[model samples]
Target: MKRNIKRIIFVVAAVAVWVGAFFMTQRLLEPKYMDDLIEGALTAEYYDETTKHDVIFIGDCEVYENFSPVTLWENYGITSYIRGNAQQLIWQSYYLLEDTLRYEKPEFVVFNVLSMKYGEPQSEEYNRLTLDGMELSPVKIKAVEASMTEDEELITYIFPILRYHSRWNQLKSEDFEYFFKKDKISHNGFIMRADVRPATTFPEPEPLADYTLPATCWEYLDKMAALCKENDIELILIKAPSLYPVWYDQWDEQIVEYAQKNGLAYINLLDKCDEIGIDFYSPETADTYDRGLHLNLSGAEKLSNYFGGWLCSNYQITDHRNDPDISAVYSEKSADYYAMKEDQLRELSEFGELKSY
Candidate 1:
């Protein structure tokens, strides 16, 4: 009996030590988006939302960089969140929508159509930005299965340490600082950039033999629409005003047809740029950070103001800025948002460029 008791105690102690070590190693290995790779942190930050939003936007950098949820709240009393990442694919957007339905059901879901151009997974790095932040669930599992490129392994996602263990040499102060806790990198999923660079000359888009969207892209679009319908949620489709990546007319036709068939509202903001008061040709008016690919803070605010008015006139979304609880939370967010803008401006003034993102 004494020997058996000692053996049992030994096993228990061994298991406890192993568990602790496993978690510690995992923490150290995981990427901390505190300093760089901030886009990787945007998707996961939605889980920290204390108040529910009336609108949820999902897509790639187009939505996150172009839209400001905080602006929506302040200007139109509309509450919103953007579930966006770098190069988010169509299937990933669908799974994210599914994952979001697991939480509070928003009145409207805005999906950018740029992702529909991609049929298969694009890159492992982009997949990490959009998927790594998602909490484990059936939705996340499906997203991983759908988004993994040929070079990716599902087991690496489940045990990220397996994928990142080799990053030991690359570990920095941020890894230790945000090992257990991560700082908020977005204001309601909106990643703000307060710098400006005018639209510049770029290589013209190569003509494609086939402008048709992939069948797989259509499949996920149908699934997303059906999911929204089943949940009694309205899904609005829009083409964000990106000057490049060339919004082909053929692609626009398909989206228009899909919207008509499904009875969904589709807005091609590219065509409405003039009406939205966006002057893409003039950097002095509508500024962009990386040439014309993504909007800067000024452009985002302009777009958001226009979108807010359109949303109010079209939908029955409630303005939560008046509710004491919601107002209190957003007031704090507003302070942070302005403080960040000031900080970025100061950096730009001092360095002639943004040193930190």
Candidate 2:
């Protein structure tokens, strides 16, 4: 009996060591996203929020790069968060919403409509950028299944070490520096760019044979609408004022019809660029970082200010600035936001580009 007990303890010890080693290797192999491709770090940062948000924005780069949550809080005291990733698909957006519901529910969910143009998974790199930051859950499993390309494997995601094992020799200082903890890369899901690249020119958009958005996109969108309704959360659809990868009139019409038929509100910001004070033409006052592709700090703040007012007018979103608990949190966030802006501007002035942001 004593021999049997000793054998059992030995087995348990061996299993624990193996499990620890496996996870440690996984952590070591995964890209830190500290220096390069910092966008990959945005998704996981949401899990660290101490205070609840009144509004949640989920979509792609359009939502993340175009709106500033800090501006929303400062102008209207509207607490909000953006759960966006680069090229995040419609199905991925739906699944992200599902995952977010596990946390606090917001009064409103704002979705950018640009991702509807993609009917299928776009690329493996984009898939990793979005999914790697998500916590392991059923929603993540579904998202991975829905977003994987033909060459991707499920096991690679499950054990990222499998995919990144080759990175052993290519490892940088950040890989070890941020092994246990990662530095925050975004300001409440807003990627700040203080530099302005004026809209000089754009390639002509090619005419598509079919202007209709895919049924798969519509199906996921339907699910998003239903989920929001069930949770008593109002869903607002908006087309951000991006001047490239063109927002054709045909696509806009379909979104308009969907919003009208479902009694939802949809705003095409392109139509209101003049009213919103967005200047894409002037280099001195341009608010874009990549020639009208994504909004810079100036543009994001303007858009956030206008949208915050519209949200206050339309919904019951409260001004939480006076709440001591939430106020303390946001006050610190505001400081960090300004500090980052200062750093980016300094880098731009000295180097003619941003190096650290």
Candidate 3:
């Protein structure tokens, strides 16, 4: 009996040490992990807390790629942000809106309808969670506690263990300090892009005969639409800019139906491109040439600026023009816009506008 008690005591001490170390590693490494990956893991917690925008754009990856919050702040005086991800389908958008409404009372929240049409709820890999979602910053904790549903609040957004399957790999490393080191986060809180170069190209996705909505999506969407109505926030639904041929059949019609039914403003830029003469087809316009699933920076500028100008017409927001500090942050970002403009201006000046123009 005495020998058994000693063995039990030793086991208890070992367990105590292990628990202490795991928490120690997690606490020490948390800042760096947030700097590196939180933007993609947690939403509703991190992004919206630091976000001080008059307008916040939420959707799927289409929102991030196509909207430059800097440009929105610079040109129109309206502060905006893209809280988008790769697989933020319609249902997730509903939850996100519910989450955002807890703290941020932006003048307008833009929703991209692409994922509303094609994204899958079970396909979490494709689900886009932003640094905004995972931030454990003091504000992040409050945002999660105040805004999110008990399930998302407890599982995915705050703790993040339920969302990222790969986190265990970090735990297994030998030198595996749980801490990540990052040089910076932006003044306005979007993680600054470390590299000026373009991200890897994705191949054009194959066309599907019939694009269908996931059954789980309708409930969240219904909730989101109702939430906007109740709060009196103008919910603008846009069929985000994508290549025409790639957009396939009745895409606009389906989104249009949703928009009209919800009394949301819908912008179909594909159809609007006729008035603007920005061709989504033609190799010259599509610099990446990967068959139109994604656009190079040049294409993104045309689309973003066009949509930016269009969005400004509806909302009244703060002008960031006089903010020299904000200008400093954007100077490096202007490279993408400058490069794109050079091509467009040179093309226009040399040929006096192409067959498209």
Backbone clashes in model 2, listed as residue pairs: none
Tens-place lDDT digits, model 2, residues 270-321: 9989889999879777989889999899999999999998999988788988
Q: Candidate 2 regions off by >4 Å?
A: none
Off by over 4 Å in 3: 1-20, 26-51, 118-120, 127-215, 244-246, 274-291, 315-357
Instruction: List TM-scores for all candidates, in order.
Output: 0.97, 0.98, 0.63
Model 1 local distance difference test score: 0.90
The residue-by-residue lDDT of candidate 3 on 1-357, one tens digit each, is 999999999999999999787656544433333334444543533342343556667776566555555555556655665666555666556656655666677778788777655433333333334333343555345434433433453345554433544555554332244344332222222322211222233457686776765454556566667787788777787766555335545666766787788778888765765554444445444422234444444555566567667776665655666777655545554564455446556665676552221
The whole-model lDDT of each prediction reads: 0.90, 0.93, 0.54
Best by TM-score: 2
Alpha carbon lDDT of residue 43, candidate 1? 84
Candidate with better TM-score, 2 vs 3: 2
Model 3 error, position 246 (Å): 4.2
- Candidate ranking under lDDT, highest first, comes to 2, 1, 3
